[model samples]
Target: MAAGPGRYSKRVRRQQDILQILAQEPTMRVKALAARLEVTTETIRRDLEELAEQGLISRTYGGAMLRAEAEPALSQRERELVKEREAIARSAFRQCAHGKTFMIGSGATTAILAKRLAFELRNVTVIAHSFAVAMALAQNPTIRIIMAPGIYHAGEGAMHGAQTIRFLQDYAADWAILGASALSPDGPSDALFEAADVYGTMLRQASHNMIVADHSKFDRMATARYAQWSEIETLVSDRRPEGPLMRALERREVQFILAEG
Candidate 1:
């Protein structure tokens, strides 16, 4: 028996309705979906197959599930290093003066300092390449936030490009708080070439360069060097080195501020 045009149209509508429902609550079984849509189990299977092919869901043995979201969360790293980050942030804030313009680079520690500065400091201008830092300071009316425009890097939550460098050239800050992937007696290190260029520009535009890092970052080296030891005025770290490395920094006149744990 041939199905009427109206009946065929209604079936197509039912399939779309089922797909929408599954999209909202994606772990529904075929039998459950059939019952909800008042359709047979075979019809539910066909709908699931169609949706799965469109990259919306995955077909399990008895059910369908939504595709997982792709962004990584900071919860794991934050939980493990909360104490270290807090100590670094507190020490970094001390270097900042009221009514001074500052530039903060991207990193977990610097991001925390941005939030702290927004609340603790008054009438300050903050220039940052970090989206996270900008968002943190956006709520404070007293602190003016200027974001450097460029290509956004999701991992660092910062923008980087030739435009970013050009924008930074126009203004000089009283101080710049920066983060490094690694730090040795030789200098601050970074893994990306573009990041190195941006950091270099920030250092050139600032009067004083302060580095914020945790204990683990010391004595480590990455692919590129951003700043030499003499360029850094103060080192704000959670841990202070002893022995020969400490002596090396002292000979270079690099002031180290060990944050209280």
Candidate 2:
């Protein structure tokens, strides 16, 4: 008999979990993958075969690994990872009650969260450095928008510089909702130096700090390491982190929220 829809869904999730694991460690043997995911080695072998056929992963003698690729532009990134980012945005939106104020940072995921807040939240205030973020929240007339002053980065569609950092210091918010170019054991980092500085300042200006990222960012490092693990209050992502990164977050007592689509 054919597998049920539920079983097929489970297999898909398991395959994604395998990809996420490889993203962290670069490679994994079938035996180790089965043990980590709590499935049979034969199951893992079949999954690897499917993944390899899909060209999402490369197959080795007894394992699978991620193919190395350079980072894409901001426009490209926003178009990629649509489902994962939407799930992350939904999970992060739960923290935004009607009357709370937030310091929102720039990124594809954060923009999605802003759109969610605009649609579902009322009487909220958002202080943001990104033009895209501001425009997204502007859709809701009830939500007040405060755009930071700084040098505009056309590529990122965001504001960054000393002006933005200094402006953030003057106000406090309930939460700082941000995104990461890369999230590693060291913490969340960004590719832009000025943007990293702005994010770090936002973290300080808020009572609680939350990062919205996808599994693709796991175990990756960028140009600037913005905040230490302890500085972040929560992480909402498509998958729960594993290995040393999980241990690091646990040691710092960061809340890990898994977003289910």
Candidates' C-alpha lDDT = 0.77, 0.86
Clashing pairs in 1: none
Residues 103-139, model 1: lDDT tens digits: 8888777888888987788788999998878888887
Model 1 whole-model lDDT (C-alpha atoms): 0.77
Work out the TM-score per prediction.
Answer: 0.69, 0.74
Worst 10 residues of 2 by lDDT: 65-74
Best by TM-score: 2
Write down the worst ten-residue block by lDDT for model 1.
68-77
In TM-score terms, candidate 2 sits at 0.74
Stretches > 4 Å off in candidate 2 = 1-70
